[model samples]
Target: MYDVVIIGAGPHALSLLSRMLINTPDKYEERPDNKSLFFKNKSGVYKTKVKDNPQTRNTPRQLSTYLRKGGVIDENVLNNICVIDRHGGWMTQWSKQFDALGISHLRSTSSIHPDAFDLHTLVQFAEDHRREGELLEIDGGIRGSKFTGPFIVPSLGLFWDFCKSVVKRHKLEDFVTKGFVTRLLPKDGGYDVCLASGDVIVAKQVVVATGNIGVKRIPGWARDVYDGCVDGSLLHTWDIINNSDATGIHTSDVCKQMVKLNMRNPINNTGNTVVIVGGGLSSAHLVVKAAMSGADQIHLVCRSSIKVRQFDLELEWIGRSRFIKLADFYSMKSFEKRSHVVRSSRGGGSITPYVHQQLVKLQESGRLIIHEDTEVWECNKDENHWSIQLSNGHMVDCYIIWLATGSIVDVTMNPLFCDVIKELPINIIDDLPVLTDDLEWGCGSGLYVMGALGGLVLGPDALNLAGARGGASRIAHRLKC
Candidate 1:
């Protein structure tokens, strides 16, 4: 039995693991009465005698010490913890999404990353690698704040490299078990994590770090039309990006080159037409990527006018006044109000200025068309061509249709929590479980949740990198206690 079994190996999971490892108690002793074994419980202190030692603080010296130790890790933590993911690798899905969408840079700054040892670890890595050029500074005007920049926005390649270094430094690669968890059964104050491969791992504590484990939001008109279309012709951004072999495009700098090439030599007309639905960042990326790939008539269909912003939420949420904003969010006694704040803060899917600029350039060259205040009323597939009916009473013939509509995360409908809800009986508000301040499911249940599910507590940025850092730190601190 493992002390802790974490489901999912995304950036959020990585953050939690890194923090837990770095903060493990320096010394521990088996209880005298229970010397034969250390029984696991929600308290996490059934038979262990831990000294009142300050956790290894997040400092440069501590990080250096951890690195110098090389292959050595705290057995008190590593031996008892296990991480599981479908791909069995850190940030695999994240990289795939970026590659599929042809994203070259990240919207968030360097301050927000997976490493919990030191907040500035990524910036340090850039300096060490002499890859400072890869770190692009967000314009002061775009930042909407007085805060200046030192090229804090690290390129995709640089960020991935830094994450790889963190994984290697902590020797986390070998700790990951490749498996798809289908169900989590609570038994004897613990959980029997059942995987699709017919294997079960028992653990005292479970952390659900799966990002966006929600139902795909398919427009009502396209629901039935999707099944009738060719396998690859109709797909959601999630499906295309998550599937390994979905997109043939190579990852990384290829996307940057394509954008530049398409802008320089615009293709005014061609036989291919690709229609993209939605106006989020993914939609913007796909629009440019499709045009770059030589799709002459690329149409972007959005129900509302395009919203351009540097980040998903406003800059105030991540700026110097972030704490003040967070305090206001937490002051709310009602989850409904908190949820409203999250929705209002997000203000629906918006694209970054950089990607929006690319779309503008494509539109100017007459290769791309933005259909705002429009919706796909109906779609019919005929001989591999999609006749898309718009709300404006216009018909469009396209070879492929891409749905960039985001997902809807309803915890009540999530199958993983069906049994958990029955066993623990926690209050559910707007499909989000009312978790403890520590993000625990119920009173001493040992099961925890992160990501969007923790929105009530973590606020609007619960699904972003900033949320990863905050959520991971809170959970790690709870585990230590």
Candidate 2:
């Protein structure tokens, strides 16, 4: 029995948990009578102790079923707020995923980290690594690149080291458990968390940060038209490459597969054709990686004109510096206006400044081709190759098709909280849950959401580190931690 239970032990969860710990009470002990609530719920449902606060009692019971939101959890809640994750340890599989994808650094800037007090934790991390020279001032330039002269991108190695340091400094490993959360059912004053390991956890508060585990979106167009034509040629970024049962999970199977293909047939061979669909930051990175990996020919198909920018939403939303602007947008009373603002701020097929330059260079050298303002309408698996027809009537074929189409946020895909969701009288819009002003999914239930699932209130920044910070701060304040 715990006060709060965080689901998913990734970067977002780490950030939230760090803040909660920072605000944790030196002595976290519930009253004698209140403490027994822990053992009382062993059968499945726990009768939670409620506060006498009117605002809390009237609050709804809605919660972001899948999220990793943060800030100073109640001190009494700290001891009980153990983290639950499918993968063992913190950020192990996530780091492996990035390594497999060949990503050099995160799209976010340095100020974003798990430390509740240290906004410059990552920046300080780079400095401590004797890589101060490699540290890029995130301003007036690309999100993660230097502002001037030689554009320096933080190597993934540096980022991994920093993550390890955070986990170590916070002693996060002690509070984590390995198991996939199969379902969450609300009863009495709290929720019951069921895991694949045949264990049940009763939590008064919950934060879910499952990174859309195994949930990939490959565009309904291709799936509905061609059935078996999309077999071996298609792959999603989140899919485990080779399905390794190794210690940590890897989300870079597509990148590794393409690299393997490039290894078998070097660029000089000119035999293999690799087509990459979607043009977001992931696709942008994939294009550079695929071209450099010796793929004979690479085609980048984007539905919209490739918009080059630092971050996905806007230059202001980077790091918490300009986050106030986003908060202002969230305050709007008009849902239509809010939806429009979110849609207009979206940078769907956008690439970083450096990747934009790489695309230009690739095109000039005739190594990579860009089908801008086009989409893959149909695909047919041919004899050891894939035949693809673009929305613009263009046709091409490739040995493999890596779809960087991104993840699906449709809450229906994830049924872990179906029982809980049904019991809550919460409103849903656009397949997203409606949240309160403080980003809490419900008012009094102590249920908060972060990541893509909290987009309704966090706006476009919900899934990023900045949003995690904001969510943490709000929840911590609510808990008076």
Highest TM-score scorer: 1
lDDT of 2 by residue, 1-481 (tens): 7777788888778877666666433111111122421223334332323221101111111111101132333446456677888876787667756665667766666655566544444555565456766555434555332222122345567766776766665555566888888998877777788998889999887777775555677787666533454344466655533344364333234344555444344333335567888889888777776776656678999888888876777654443234234535534666656656665667565777766887899899997889999988778764456678898888887766777888777665677657757777577677777777665656776566667776666667667766676566555555432
Question: Which lDDT tens digits does candidate 1 get at residues 195-300?
Answer: 9999999999999998987478998998887766545667788776765442454321223323433433323332467789998998899888787766767899
* TM-scores of the models, in the order given: 0.85, 0.79
Which parts of model 1 are misplaced by more than 4 Å? 24-72, 145-151, 246-270
User: Against the unseen true structure, what C-alpha lDDT does each candidate score?
Assistant: 0.75, 0.63
Candidate 1 clashes between residue pairs 3 or more apart in a chain or in different chains: none
Candidate 1's displacement at residue 311, Å, is 0.7
Superposed model 2: Cα runs more than 4 Å off: 24-78, 137-154, 224-231, 240-270, 319-324, 479-481
Tell me how many residue pairs clash in candidate 2.
6
- For candidate 1, the clash count comes to 0
